[model samples]
Every structure is written in C-alpha cells, then in structure tokens.
Target: MRIRSDGLAARSFDAETVVLDLEKSQYLTLNETGSLLYELLRQERTMDELVDAVVAEYNVDRVIAMRDVEAFVGSLREHGLLTGSDVLA
Candidate 1:
C-alpha cells in the first residue's frame, strides 16, 4: 500500500527515517532497514516485493527478510502510517 499523506510528513536523514503523524500528534523514527522499507511503501509494494528488497539490500536470507518485513509493516500498521485497502494484502 501507500503511505498516508493526508496528515503525515516524512523525512530521511542518513540511514534513518522520521515520520510525523500530524493527525495523531505522534512521531516515529525508523532505522536504516526500516527507512528503506518505508521509502518503498511510498509507492505501492506487495509483501514479496518488500521481502525481496530487504534480501537484495542486506543479502539476508529470505526467511529472515520476510520476518523482518512483516514486523516492519505491522509496526507501520499499528501506528496508522499506511493507507489503501491493499495495505495487508
């Protein structure tokens, strides 16, 4: 899915990503890998694409990449950072 831009703002610095959820008055800081995934989500990505990106970027095992990607996406969902019906698809 895509990032919700309505009341959210995001910035990247070095290998980190910072997201400001103006509607919620909350903010989140993401590490390097999280930043990569977040940037990808700016467009639209399926779960497999996310996992593959992690694997290609870090040379991690597919299983590990899948796990990490899921956790990252779940965290984004928990924080209400994602939009569109395909977010969890």
Candidate 2:
C-alpha cells in the first residue's frame, strides 16, 4: 500500500470524475468511484482503510472494491505515479 505524488497531477471534472496526468507522460481517467479512491490515496490511507472507505462511499461489495483498488494502485505504480513511499516528501 504505497502512494506516490511525484510527477502526478489530478483534476476533477464535473465532480463526477478525475483526470490524472502522470509525469506529464501518461493519463488515467477515473470515474466517480476512482476519483473518490484517489482522494483517499492522497491522504495516505492504508489498504484496508482504503477498501473500507470505498465500500462506504459506493454501493459496491467489499470484495469488488478491494479488487478495484488493488488494480488501480498497481496501475498507478506502473506509471511511476506511486513510489512505495510518501510522495509528498
């Protein structure tokens, strides 16, 4: 459960989605749920906490939220948007 902030920029659109530009090198388009999850990631929440947050915010099952968050986090890491450490520092 690592989150990196370096070379990553995010913008919310219509309060319905989030557009994340990573390293000015690639982009990730997230829906309402993803946007919410991203916001929580910014706060450096743990994996369990993140899953709980997602479940509370959306009408999805815990299993589904956990899977989705895992996938999303993987993608963010692959894009170098997340560094396995506090990115703000």
Candidate 3:
C-alpha cells in the first residue's frame, strides 16, 4: 500500500519532525528516526521498501525495522496524518 501525505503540513529538523494536520488542527512530533521515515514516505512507498531503507541506513535488523515502521504508520493512521489509497483527501 502507498501512503501519501495529503493535507498535512510538515517540517523536519535535524533531529525531529513536526507535522501539522490543518484540517484536524492537531500535530505530531517525531524524533530523528521518525523524521527520516516520514521523509521517505512523503511519496509512495511499500512496507518492504520502507523497512529495507531503514535497515540499510540504520543497520538495524529487518524484523525490528519492519516492526518499528509498521508501528509508526499505525500511529499516524490513528491520528489521521496519513491518507490511505482508498481514502479521499
């Protein structure tokens, strides 16, 4: 599945990410790793693709990377930060 950052305003610093959901008037703060992941997913990315990138970049185990990426996406979805393929922006 692809995740698109539609309708959200995001800013990334060296160590953190600040995402603003203008529609909901809610925001999220993410650490260095989360910022990188979100930057990667700004376009369309598959689960494996995301995990692979993280593993390669951070030298983490594939299992751990996959789990972490999934959890991050889950939280974004929960907070309405991600726009799923089937959802309208």
Number of the top candidate by lDDT?
Answer: 1
Q: Compared to the true structure, candidate 1 yields what TM-score?
A: 0.91
Which scores greater on lDDT, model 1 or model 2? 1
Question: Candidate 3 on 13-77: residue-level lDDT in tens?
Answer: 77898988888898899997788888877777677777888899999999999889889888877
Misplaced by over 4 Å in model 2 are 1-3, 16-24, 85-89
Error of 2 at 54 (Å): 1.1
Clashing residue pairs in candidate 2 are none
lDDT of 1 by residue, 3-77 (tens): 776898888999998999999999999999999998898897888888889999999999999888889888888
Runs off by more than 4 Å, candidate 1? 85-89
Per residue, candidate 2 scores C-alpha lDDT tens digits across 1-89 of 44465666677876555455654666778777777777777766677777788888887899998888788777767766664543212
Error of 3 at 33 (Å): 1.2
Model 1 scores worst on lDDT over the 10 consecutive residues at: 80-89
The Cα local distance difference test for each model comes to: 0.87, 0.70, 0.78
